[model samples]
Target: MTVPAFSLRNAVRASAPLAGALLLVGCVTGSDIEGLHRHVGDVEKRVDALAKQSSSKEEVAKLNENLGKQVATLLRSNADLGAKFDELTRELQTLAGKLEDANRRLAQLSQQLAETQARLAAAAPPDAAALPTSEATPGTAPPVAPAPAVASAPPRGGAPSPADLYAQATADYQRGQFELAREGFEDYVERYGRTDLSDDAQYWAGESLLAQKKPREAIAAFEKLFKTWPESDKAPAAHLKKGVAHLDLGEKAQAIVQLQFVVHEYPSSDEAKSARQRLKALGSDSR
Candidate 1:
């Protein structure tokens, strides 16, 4: 019985030595464990650096995208502004052109007005006896009427009548001697203001004033003809001349009204033709 107990104890002791040998064989080397720890630390450092670099790159890319968007918006805004500036410049150029044209027309009108006033002050009145007389026929006899009982007197050459003087004045006017013609015409009108030639004299007198560049006096003469002889053949012409006088005075609205009346009332007359031409020049030929 004692031998059986020793055998169990010895079997347990032999198992303990076997277990210690296996432990020694399976244990890690010191150098290998240290190398593994160093490798793990390097990996941790590399991961941290990689994460920081990746975050920086993402931030830079986002900033670049935002900058690109801002630059694009600025370019678009600049283009829009440039387009508006171009439109405004064109509009200003058009307006300037219009103003220049208006100024030129105004200057022309002023020059015309000044010239028209200079001729009015130099006109003169006419002399009746200075008019030419027709020679007597060879067969015409001398006057034989009995003289009054006082002192005997011989008959003198008969002076030309107002009609003959007016004829001479018209001939002078046609020959371009407007100053002399204007005097004669005015004399005829004054001497024969109640005669049938009064209206004709008045009209020709105004025409002479116009030929002399006396638009104000011409206007007065024409207005007198129109008012005094509304039914005369010269009425339309008088109104036409009056319109021209208004134009000389820079009265465009009044000139247009009078010219329109001429065109409307005397459509078939030469005066109407002149009025239409004037209306076209004034840019008011809508009719």
Candidate 2:
């Protein structure tokens, strides 16, 4: 592997032209070098895309399927929510219907209680015999006396109990003694004005006046009751009777005003029902 000094010198001299020619041929411009780099980069990008093409398509397909499943789940949830909403609506409607029916039944029971308390104040068998039983006897004649009220009068120089006085007053009214009934009820209203039955006594006084065919006096009595005891449960009945008294006197305008008042102020009362009937008969039903 060692060469003589003269042979090495000769070999270097002979390769000088070849080295110069090689340098001259490799002298490229900057633009030509950049173009070669761009070509290499483009080739590398094309190869990478071709190698991943099938995998990229498969990944996109999987993504689309996952999205479809999510959409279907959302649709099912919406359907379930809609069904629940419909069920709640139906349940509320049923509850409202039941509440309305219960209200109607309660109104009827209260009306019956307000109209009938004769059995509570009956003093003896004779008084009891004068009233109808729980069920009506269809063939019985129309009542010759009061429909269902009577009590023996209290007898003493001292003042009687409130109950006995009230019972006796009602008894007088029922027994066709209108003047005596009016006097007794007026006395009760004057003395027992703060008692629970005071308003009722005043109302009966008006009824007594009406029974005697004194429509003007009955209206005055009703007006007194209204001013004195506006909160009485008997207010509606009083209004109805006042309206009827007006009707009996051929005062159609006055009757309409009173009847319409009942329909408006006591819509749930039995008197309201009667008022509505009367209004219909007078060709002025308020509906």
Candidate 3:
């Protein structure tokens, strides 16, 4: 019985340490569960932050896309406006040019009318007594001497002088006897080339030829006037008529040269104005 009691005491001592180890293990398990809960909460918070960042990036992309579209639309609108402005500018330029041309034509007409009135005022009244004697039938004019002769002394009275011959030729020209007038004027120029009215007679001879559609003869007469009386008051008129005669002969380059000469040499004269008009018609831009 003493040996049995001693075995029981040893067993009790071992059981006491085993009970303490079990209690410590239970406390450690509870602390581990609390740490697991904290880790799960941190992971959830991180996922929420990532979701918000993704949504913000999507919103920013949409806003940027809308802004790009608006900028493209504005650029297209500006380009269209620029094209319309350019078209309007061209139309305005065309209209302005047409208006300028109309104004120039109006001015030319006024000048022509004024010149006609001045000429009528300067001309002398017609004499009925002189008209019947000077009026010759068409194609039935009296013959003038082929070569001019020295004027004979009047029959004890003052006969018509060289000046009277010029006046009679002018009358024939006014009556549209261009052939007879041309011959008479040529005779006057040949015989009285140094007289005061010689240049006038020569110029009228050219006019007579031009009226009869004789461009070559007209050109020759005008050239003679230019060479013989370069300082005459009719020089500019001769140049102008010579240019017209060249045009009649279908000599465009020669016409331009003669017209240009008139314009350059007599810029302030009526002949120059006519030359400018002719040049404009011929597509020359000479001022």
Candidate 4:
């Protein structure tokens, strides 16, 4: 029979802050014990005995069986402590893996964003002042063309430009106004779908639904984002969030599939770290 899943909340609490440092200490301790077990060398055997004093109470108890009851009890107590340390070491290694994955993703995101910015800068319109000047005849000014008539006047209450719409949507999201944010983001996506920020607008529209606890709607929104912008920079994040939405709806199987896809396809992404954590919480083997 399968073992019951461990409580993620409890695990998080036990890990606290110093978990990573402890992993290194545990690795050293385990390695020393291993070398002695294998009879690697005299020096290693000496290190192993010392390390084992603090790392394995069972060994101490067996070796000092002829000692007094007090010594036996102390040795047993140390063994129990060692067991707990071993468990903590395993948990710390898992956390370290997740942290390393997250850092790699952040670096990739920074690089991708920098490249996007560079492309945008390179594509920016030339300054009007850089336009070539035409020489006028000595006695006359250059002929000027009449400005084109406005096709339509600006609305009495000026409609928000694309940038204004995006800012308003982001502010609404930050303020926890999920419904308003959803509407604003949807509007932005609909009106400016060809703009650079459209993918971001689409992604946040799903996030707003998620914030409102509408996981079904959020899933649909995320699906639409993927369908509409398959090549979007936000695609991996959208997949990750979609998996979370599935979890919120208690669709464990679908959640696993979506999260696994992120892990395999975007292994170096921050979203993949989150996906892996969720998979761990769900007792799914990401490997």
What does candidate 2's lDDT look like per residue over 46-157, in tens digits?
5556546746877999999999999999999999999999999999999999999999999999887655433322312122243235433221111122232555465576
Residue ranges of candidate 2 with Cα displaced over 4 Å: 1-157
- 1 or 3, greater by lDDT: 3
What's the alpha carbon RMSD for model 4? 38.1
Work out how many backbone clashes candidate 2 has: 0
Q: TM-scores of the models, in the given order? A: 0.43, 0.46, 0.45, 0.46
Candidate 4 accuracy as TM-score: 0.46
Candidate 2 RMSD computed on C-alpha atoms after optimal superposition onto the true structure: 18.2
Q: Which regions in candidate 4 have their CA more than 4 angstroms from the true location? A: 1-157
**RMSD, one per candidate, in order:** 22.1, 18.2, 20.5, 38.1
lDDT of 3 at 247: 74
Better model by TM-score: candidate 2 vs candidate 3: 2
lDDT assessment of candidate 1: 0.70
lDDT of 2 at 202: 89
Q: lDDT by residue for model 4 over 1-287, one digit each (tens)?
A: 52222333343334433444555677546565544435434444555465555457666776677577778789999999999999999999999999999999999999997885565344423232432234221111111222334434534578767766777777777777879989998998887899877887888888888879999999999899889999998888889878877767766667778989999999997777767766766656677
Number of backbone-clashing residue pairs for each candidate, in the order shown = 0, 0, 0, 0
- Give every collision pair in model 1: none
Q: Which pairs in model 4 have colliding backbones?
A: none
* Model 2 residue pairs with clashes: none
